[model samples]
Target: MPEEVIFESESDRSREEIAAYLRTVADNLESGEGITLKSDGDSLSLDPPTHSTFEVKAEREGPEGGPKELSVEFELEWPEDGETESESGELEIE
Candidate 1:
């Protein structure tokens, strides 16, 4: 089964702004040196310097219902010589 990765941050900005920011981040991650993305449909696999692979799923939820939330889900596989680690960053609306 695939794992769910969720990124939750409270932002007073509009959804469009948040989505744009995320797109930028994703694009940067995809094009950054030593990082690559192999994707199909709703899934993405990432390979980084540690020789690990990560499967990612990202989406947004908001005003159409209640408070806004940016959700990202993924499962990581570490390299034979490395251990898997999880990290996150928040963007504040100003």
Candidate 2:
């Protein structure tokens, strides 16, 4: 499926700063509030359903003889109808 680009912002940040941002998002999710992401003059508000698809991915990309770049991504996906099936699993982060 084709995707539309929304408000986007990315830059290098300290680990402490990144943790702070993630904490804010976690708080909002726990409170069942829409998340508003703003960067410069662009902004987007997303109201995820109570049950949504949560995904976590980790990847490494690099040339055969070069250094590798590692990245971890977290995402939440839900349909416009706000219907989703809940899944149970064990995830340990550390």
Winning candidate number (lDDT) = 2
lDDT of 1: 0.55
Least accurate stretch of 10 residues (summed lDDT) in model 1? 33-42
Residue clash pairs of candidate 2: none
lDDT of 2 at 10: 96
Residue-wise lDDT of candidate 1 within 54-91, one digit each (tens)?
56667897898688889876544565465556545453
What does candidate 2's lDDT look like per residue over 1-94, in tens digits?
A: 9999776799999999999999988999999998999888888899988888888999999999999999999988899876589988788889
The CA lDDT of each predicted structure is 0.55, 0.90
Q: Show model 1 residue runs off by greater than 4 Å.
A: 1-9, 33-94
Residue 43 error, candidate 2, Å: 0.5
The TM-score values for the models, in the order shown, are 0.30, 0.91
Residue 38 local lDDT, model 2: 88
Q: Following a full C-alpha superposition, what root-mean-square deviation does model 2 have from the true structure?
A: 1.2
